[model samples]
Target: MRGGEKCLEVFCEIFPEADLFTLLHVPGSVSPVIEGRRVVTSFLQRFPGVERRYRHLLPLMPAAVRLLGLGGYDFILSSSHCVAKAARGGPGAYHLCYCYTPMRYAWSAYEAYFGGDRLRGAARWVVPPVMKALRRWDAGTSAGVGEFIAISHTVAGRIRSCYGREAEVIYPPVDTDLYHPAGEPGDYYLLVSAFAPYKRVDLAAEAFTRLGRPLKVAGTGQDFERVRALGGPNVEFLGWQDDAALARLYAGCRAFVFPGEEDFGITPLEAQACGRPVIAYGAGGALETVVGLNPEEVTFPAGFQPPAGEEPTGLFFTRPDAEGLAQAVLRFEAEEAKFRPEAARRQALRFGRERFKEQARRRFVEGFERHQEKTAARRTGDR
Candidate 1:
């Protein structure tokens, strides 16, 4: 499961009977924890080839969400980075959103997703106005959410900026049991992410090309061809990997390469859980999760030491481009021996799946009970 699905899994365990509402639901596409639920899909699920063309159906998502039936439920919990936040609850119904971020498409990710070579022809011109309307709709609908929980401070900031709303930070979970350290790491560095524009997979391809080092990128999405075009023979793209294969990839990688500034990434922690250190861009959620050691020669002064006092789980490059990442990789190679597999695994343990489930259950229960009290008072006053 990806970050969102991982979070959803915790909720499924918390509330087994909660109806899953979405614009689309491909059977068996997600974990059994979710698939076993009473899943309700919107009108878009009926549209021909909608599953493949769903990202293109952005303009229709608001309407699609509106058609979703949640009449009987007084508490609607949304795991959203996009349209789910717009799912309106029935009168006095409490909508609790575990936000990944304000919708990236409707926020500052325009240049990455719609600009440059990512978007072309008439559609490039067409999508901006749609995004603008979505931004308004996104902000307008924030009123429905009784509370917002962000996966990280980075995402919490975006929620405030986008919707003029506040959010409590609740870091997501990683399945430490499933991702524990296994065999020895291999020669290649691993970069696992969907080829979304903001992910900067193209930069990873370019960085490995410059270093002439082995780097394998797992997962594919809208920017696949563009990223593949930037790579040399040194870089290999593995389309999509299952959980078992992915665990092996993480446990066997020399180090995980994370080039994106995420809301709060799960992959790096997953890699750490598998006893792999990460080489990442020093921003966003990476700062929170990674115990990043900066290079003495480059990042610090002649005598200056970068200190975590215990152990460093990863290395961070202040620069976000290919050259920055390539240099960080070199620094990582130089300081590689200092990083231990078990140490990294210990760091990953702090964000274990069970811990997140506990936190989620507590928050959801508290919010649901508080909402019930408020609803009772309102009904009593009406009488």
Candidate 2:
């Protein structure tokens, strides 16, 4: 599962009895926790071959979301990265949307999802108008939601910019217990990610290839073939691995590479939980997660000196390119001894499942109370 599905699993644990509404669901694709719930899929689920080719059906998502009747539920919690946030609830129901982002494809990430190479032929012409319409609809639907909760400060900024609405930030959960270190570091570096255009997996593959170091990439997606072609003999593509295999890989790697700009990246935290230092692009959620040496703190004439009692867990490269990543790897090797495994593991513990659950409970209670107060005030004004 990706970050969004992992979030859905946590929601399932919180509201086991709540009905799940989604565009489509592939049976056995998600965790048992999510699958066990009474999943209420949209009209999109009835279409043949929708499971594998869902991206092709993006144009119809708004209509499909509207078709889902949420009137029966008194309280609605939508785990949304897309049209799920636009689901209409009953008139009296309180709706809270856990917004992953305000539709990346329809907004600033248009080129990443529908650029010249990504979308060809008639699609090139067709998609732009559809996305423009989707953007308008997305902004209009923001009023339907009573409150918004963002997964990260990064996403909260986007929500504010795109919809003109402020949102509370709640960092998502990571299962630290499942990713404990084995106390043995392996020779190879690691990258567990999907081969999407925006993920920048190709950059890591190219960097490792140029350096002639082993880089094990463990996940598959639409751009897998393109990413594989860019890699040399040093880069290994290990298509989607099971939890056992992923855990082993995490525990053994010298360092984890995260080249993508994510909403709230979970894989880096997972790697940190396994006591592995990370080499990440200095952007997005990585800015919040990774503790790196600051250039501003160093005096030029004094030269590089390790901070007393500070154990850095990762290194960051300002640019998201092969040369930048290659330099970062070389820098990490030079200061490799300063990064303690225990310190990385300690940092990962801060975003554990229990912390998320407690925070979520408090937010839900407070939001519900605010909703009631507003409703009571409206009634009094009418009198």
Best by lDDT: 1
Error of 2 at 329 (Å): 1.0
**lDDT per residue as tens, model 2, 1-383:** 77788877877777777788888889999998888888888888989999879988988999999989988876888889888899887887898999888988898567777876877789888888999999999999999999999988778888888999989888888889898899689899999998888889989988999999999999999989989999999899999998778989999999999988888789999999999999988777776677776544322211113334556889888877999999999988899998888999988898898898888888887888999889999999999
lDDT of 2 at 154: 79
- In order, the Cα lDDT scores of the candidates are 0.86, 0.86
Q: Which candidate should be chosen as best, given TM-score against the real structure? A: 2
Error of 1 at 298 (Å): 14
Candidate 2: deviation at residue 81, Å?
0.6
Tens digit per residue, CA lDDT, model 1, 1-383: 68898788888899887778878988888898888888889888888998799887889899888778776778899999888988877777889999998888888677777776755688778887888899999899888899999998778878888888888888899889889899788999999999998898989999999999999999989889978999999999999999888999999999999999888899999999999999988777777787777534233212222345758899888877998898889988999998999889998998987889889899999999999998889889999
lDDT of 2: 0.86
Report clash pairs, candidate 2. Answer: none
Q: How far does residue 194 in candidate 1 sit from its true spot (Å)?
A: 0.9
Off by over 4 Å in 2: 295-310
Model 2, C-alpha of 7: deviation from truth (Å): 2.1
